[model samples]
Target: MYEKVINASYDPIFIADKDGYGIKMNEAYTRVTGITEDQLIGRHLKDVVKDGIISESVSLKVLKEKKQVTIIQHVNGKELLVTGNPIFDDKGNVSHIVTNLRNISALKSLEAELSRTKELANKYLQEIKIYQKKEDMISHEGVIANSRQMLNVINLVQKITPFNSTVLLLGESGVGKEVIANLIQKWSTRSNKPFIKVNCAAIPKELIESELFGYEKGAFTGADSRGRPGLFEQAHTGTIFLDEIGEMPLQLQGKLLRVLQEFEVTRIGGRRTIKIDVRVISATNKDLESLVKRGEFREDLYYRLNIIPIKIPPLRKRQEDIPLLANYFLDQANQKYHLNKQLTDDALLAMKAYAWPGNVREMQNLIERLVITTEADDITASHLPFSNQTAFVPQPIQKKMKEVLQDIEREMILKAISEYKTTRKAAEVLGISQSALVKKMQRLGI
Candidate 1:
């Protein structure tokens, strides 16, 4: 029954005589250590350790000390916590030593994972503090402007904020035109008043007229029961930001032109004209002059909105601000997603080299995605979705044909790996075996 209990125990059990010769071992001992009863039962503990079968013998230690002994042991590449207890005979002499072996590999693995998680949490906290300090210094009302062009734009905004002139913000779609509009409103006398923003492109042509100019209660089907005021009425004592003015339909352009000229708007089905005391701010990425020449836009209305045009340069043109903006966006993403991600120097270099067609908006989205998807804390050049190798790293003036070929090969492999996001898929795309691709990557230092 004692043998049955010992064999039934989940933990491995080993028993040896007081002389340190193994006397008995359970089935669990054989399963855990991969050592059969024949191999260890007749063998001495000292011999087992000498033969490199186990790291140490807790039973031997217990025998020497005449007391219980606990130790960490390694057997068959597994970590174990082993405890040995000595049994004394009636004569007060040690008679037997019994040991219990508990595998601690899973616990060790869990401990390592927890340690990594803690380290990442601490890193994220530190990153947040650093960025918060920098944000306080460099940001102006949530706008990051370090480049000369952007600084000049901000200066221009400050100059024009006191005036009620119609300001036209011209830039690429993601160039923060709306931010400039917000700045104007924030610094203007109408800061306390309502600021109505209408995206002309987002609204449908059929409803835009009613939406912008307001309509009577029964103006059309699906109309609001109570008479609703338009965006211009909503901004009677404030400012109105019209985004994507270029996409405003031509038919509605005449009414918009009249509103700009008279500061009065007649509702879609209302006879009375309401005068609005509001400042107008319009922004567009399209070339209004070209649109005017094409008759797609009204030339007269164009001049009205262009009274104080502020052209925001694209992101590629203002490369100096990339680092600041990148860090700012990274900080935001970390805060939002609870991630600890940082960009490497090479990653920053790659960003500066690439032509940001989508401008600041792309960088913001990409940073958020990296913060969420990246496994490592440091986001390196390899982690970037797009890499411009020739622009990022200056090539040597003179190179051998073999070196040139190697450069092309390296570029191709890097591009494939970055695009596919895995060695096996990249290898398949490159028409090479996974092992060959790995070997090539190693040689190229990829």
Candidate 2:
């Protein structure tokens, strides 16, 4: 019955005598080792090892050690997990050694595949996180500004909100001219009214008039049979933001000037004149003065648009704001990508020192790129693409040591006040009396 049970088992099993000689083996053992049972039974394990039928004998180790042993064994060109357990007699002597063998090639292959799958899953998860962060940052609302120049611009915007004066925003491309336009619309009394935006540069010269003024039916070939209201008429009783106004065609400029002066529009192939009450907010990156001088732009239109000119300073002129902007952008990126990343002191210094010709938009894009590509939680100078680029290095300004010390002291006092909130607490933090701290703050204009 024992022999029948052993023979019926799926795992390979072999039993050895006290002297390490094979006494009996199951049919599975013979099948696994590719050896006949007649040849295996009653044969010494050392003899099987010497004959190269099995690589090593765990049974022999168990017999010598008088304990259980497990090892990897190579037999008949297959890998196996072989375990040998000793059976003890009354005298604590190893009476027999029973060994079991299990094939391990399939398990090893499965382990490797699982490892590869985990690596791929981790890679894809990181990519998805970055994409999510980008969406979140891009969807953030409001203008990000803290510089004095920008503050003045904001003040000017606020001052003009009560009236319907035509505002002309002037700045280099990507300096957020559109953002100012939107702010104007939001602050105006007509905030609930529709604020239409039109890019003069993007529209064709032939379609400019029709796009700006409502066209009558059959006004021209391929005109919509039902007729169409132009952007100006559509923005009636609201605001119309015309971006890149310098790109307006010479002839269209005359018509636009007329509409601005008369507050009326004449549709193509139509006799009826339409009166409209729409606020015009024009923006341009080009110099309208240059265009006027070159006869490319109407001088009358330039004067009308320049009534309330607001020039947005480039990012380089507002270097003190870089730290604030950088941290803001970093926070946005972190919220977007579901990650916590910070800029190193050196990284911030490097950013502030560099000239941003592409302006605020460039800084925003760079911050996003660094957040995504950098592996470290803290973004160091090495992670910046422009860190090694040849850039403008400012000449050091000569200053007295006492003056520099005063600057450092003022900065420390401001920092302590911000952190502690109360003058007494700030004084304790700075190791000074509250009265003295107040005196210094007054002198430093803190």
Candidate 3:
């Protein structure tokens, strides 16, 4: 029964006597080695290796060591795992050695295939992450402009997208200059490359140089230990948006001009200059021409940047686009806050009437505020947040043209103040003398 069970086993099995001669072998052993049972049963283990019938025998090693052994054996161009164990008699002497062999070629192949599959899965996951990041960066559904002025700006953006030229986006604060810059990058030929944004006004003046040009190790105090690449290096073969370019210090303007002219940057502490291929897009609410006249900005840099100037019209100038922009913002607010809200005709009229001092950004904020604060599902003129009643909806008895013009003038002066740092700057932006602006501010109760 034991012999029959051994012969029926799937794994190759061999029994060798203490003298190292094969005394018994299963049919599986003959099938694996291509040696018949008659030829294998009485063959010495060392004689099989000498005759090249089998590779190194584990049974011979077990007999010599008087212990169990495991070895890899190559036979007939196939890999096999061979394990051998010595059986002892009553006097503690070796009686025979039992050996088992298993073909591991298919198992090894399966293992290699599994490793390759895991690597491919990891690569796909990384690609998904990259695509998700790009989606987040480029998605801007709120930038809707139907006004002729805005359409012209969009047209100019489309025309210049195919070429690599410096673009200077001039607009009032909250007029969506950043949104336009992102659109240019998304539509450009280098859309697949990186789009790096740097707010010159937001970054500290002391650190702006290193942040734009990168730094080697120990470049300055509190610097990264391993060194770091700056925005210019990161934007190689892509686009770098310099938001609020008017705020960059005069000292760093020369360095920036050099980069724009030579297409190269030198690290803050390193001596070597690295070449880069990048498109520059700069935006600002301030008047760069006035800045140059005041010696606050570089004239050479201004000409280089103004190669492709795109002026995004303020909300007041594009009142025709208010309904579309308002509805879009309203929908966004409802979706963001998980509410179902609609704008009444009165509410839409009120939004169109009001001079959006904060422009699109202010409109979006007002919509979100109304969506959250209003008790009813329908937003009416009463839900608007304006101090002046006439600002929300036009009255049946219209004011004189002079009075209407004064109201528009008041709103512009206030907006200019909110957009600029000082009264002089605000006056320059409003195209009025400083004394006249101050007098107007006092009369309007601003």
All-Cα superposition RMSD per candidate: 19.9, 18.2, 17.3
Candidate 2, run of 10 with poorest lDDT: 390-399
lDDT of each: 0.88, 0.84, 0.85
Q: Which portions of model 3 miss their true places by more than 4 Å? A: 1-142, 390-446
Candidate 2 backbone collisions, by pair: 133-336, 133-337
What tens digits encode model 3's per-residue C-alpha lDDT throughout 1-446?
97998999998899999998988888898788666766567888788889887789898899889999999998888888989999999998889999998888877998899999999999999999999765433333435767778878777877999999999999988999999998899889999999999999889999999999999999888999888999999999999999999999999999999999999999988999999999999999998999999999999999989998999987866767787888888888899989998998667756665766678999889889989999999998778877354552433343456656766676566556655859999999888899999998777555
Model 2 spans with C-alpha error above 4 angstroms: 1-141, 393-446
- Superposed model 1: Cα runs more than 4 Å off: 1-137, 388-446
- Choose the strongest candidate by lDDT: 1
CA error at residue 131 for candidate 3, angstroms: 29
Q: Which lDDT value does model 3 have at 353? A: 55
Candidate 3, residue 372: the lDDT equals 93
TM-score of 2: 0.56
Ranking by lDDT: 1, 3, 2
Expressed as tens digits, the lDDT of each residue in 1-446 for candidate 2 is: 98899889998899999998888888888777776866667788899889887899999999888888999999877888999999999999999999998878767888889999999999999999999666433332367667678878878988999999999999987788999999899989989998999999999888888999979999898999988889999999999999999999998888899899999988888888899999999999898898999999999999999999999987766766678788888988999999999999778867765666678889899999889999989998778776664333322343356645554565466556656889999999999999999999887555
